[model samples]
Target: MDTMRERFVSTTSQLLDEDARLALVLAEISKDGFSAARRRHPDRVINVGIREQLLIGAGGGIALTGLRPIMHTFASFLVERPFEQVKLDFGHQGTGGVLVSAGASYDWPAGGFTHMAPGDVALLDTLDGWSVQVPGHPDEAEALLRQSAARDDRVYIRLSLQTNARAHASDGKPGFRTLREGRGGVVIAVGPMLDHVLAATEGLDVTVLYATTVRPFDSAALRAAAGVQNAADVVIVEPYLAGTSTAAASEALTDVPHRVLGLGVSRRELRRYGRMDEHLTAHGLDPRGLRARMARFLPGTPR
Candidate 1:
């Protein structure tokens, strides 16, 4: 199966063909993939070289003209580097565009810390009116991307190299999907962490909730899932920063007597440049590590 990034190039190319209002701005990140599309729609498919700020600025400018722009780049450059541009160009201006990003967290370990963006989601949380989607599979990525392209909203579709073994069915709506049911607790897995989370909680009596669209966080689904039990014990496993969605989960269950444990990439940087699997194990995001941690937090859960 193709990676999410590859699927993004193909899907966005199709969008450009289907919609005249859609425009794509890139900073030489995945320029090669959109070569044919660029030839087809030279005016719409733009490559702004290595200037990250300019990439967002151009996309925002296009949005100003009433054209739906999709900005593509590495996560670090797309969100972290041009954050000011993002805040001013899109949020402050009330402009709507889709920001599609690759190189999630530590997807390319050889690229070092500069390429990783474990805090991207956390940073976006500081801003308002932004819809964030973290798709675990290429099929989900394509679906979310197409959805974002159809609307003129400030949407961020996070694409990662890590993915689940299979794609879960979605109704193209922004909410969590219940994969398993139990009264012991609820495990909410975001994006690529679903497979590992499922494995970790295999024997544990917990309801597993899969989330692709995080922002406008489906508080209702969370509430409904937790409402069955007297007390809610929630565990959020994200592919980005560990505690990125913990606060959001807490807010969703504010009235209910509950506890939340956030799991994902650690703040402590791993100095060595290793494989992605190595990084996953180091961050305690692998199945073995997750099981150990989840077992400790969940009462009566055998390790």
Candidate 2:
């Protein structure tokens, strides 16, 4: 099974080839993989080499020059390490570009906190007019990339090693898609967390909503599924930081008072490193942990 990152490299290169107005920037991560594209579009495809700050700046500059740019690197380097550049170079300049990041949450457990970015999306939330897409599978990743590339808005596509076995995007359509139906409440799964969510809500009487796009939050669809009265208890399960979208959830349910339980990576960092499953288990994001925590919030879940 090829990872979402692999698919991004493959598809993005094709985008670089097809669209002369498209440019790519890399900060040394996966630079070897894009050698051919770099050769083909030497002026458009730039490798800044360990300068994360310059990476976004170059992309911003390229956008100003009337080209859609895609900048790539690890999540931490792409977001946290050079946040000022992202904020000013793009946001201040009013220049839009697509920031594609790999290494989801604690993707490289051995790489530890410095290499991890559980708060990447939350950080982007602070900025305005940015569209964030966290696709569950590779097919959805390609589709979302192509969609974002066609626009000039600030787009952040969070790629990960974590993936679902299948793509759940509604053809090429946008917004939330229902995976399972019930009235116990809605358990919204973000990106790679779909598999874990499906496992957690297996026999529960809750409507399971799967979404690849989280930035827009799809309030209209959410309200439609959960109802305006907000009688049903809501649960949001994401692959990134926990409770990152609680405010959005609350805002959407303004008409009715409802309860929301968010499941995701904890704020505390795990000092030791092992496998991805170990990190997930530590954060209570594994299926077993998810099932346990969600059962209490949902009620009547099979023990």
For model 2, name the residue pairs that clash: none
Q: Candidate 1: where is the Cα deviation over 4 Å?
A: none
Instruction: Look at candidate 1 and tell me the lDDT of residue 84.
Output: 100
Model 1 Cα lDDT, one tens digit per residue, 1-303: 999999999999999999999999999999999999999999999999999999999999999999999999999999999999999999999999999999999999999999999999999999999999999999999989988999978999999999999899444578999999998999999989999999999988999999999998999999999999999999999999999999999999999999999999999999897999999999999999999999999988999
The numbered model that scores best in lDDT is 1
| All-Cα superposition RMSD per candidate | 0.7, 1.2
Query: Per-candidate TM vs. native?
Result: 0.99, 0.97
**Every candidate's lDDT:** 0.94, 0.88
Q: Which stretches of candidate 2 lie over 4 Å from their true place?
A: 170-172, 228-230
What lDDT is reached at residue 265 by model 2? 89
Estimate the TM-score for candidate 2.
Answer: 0.97
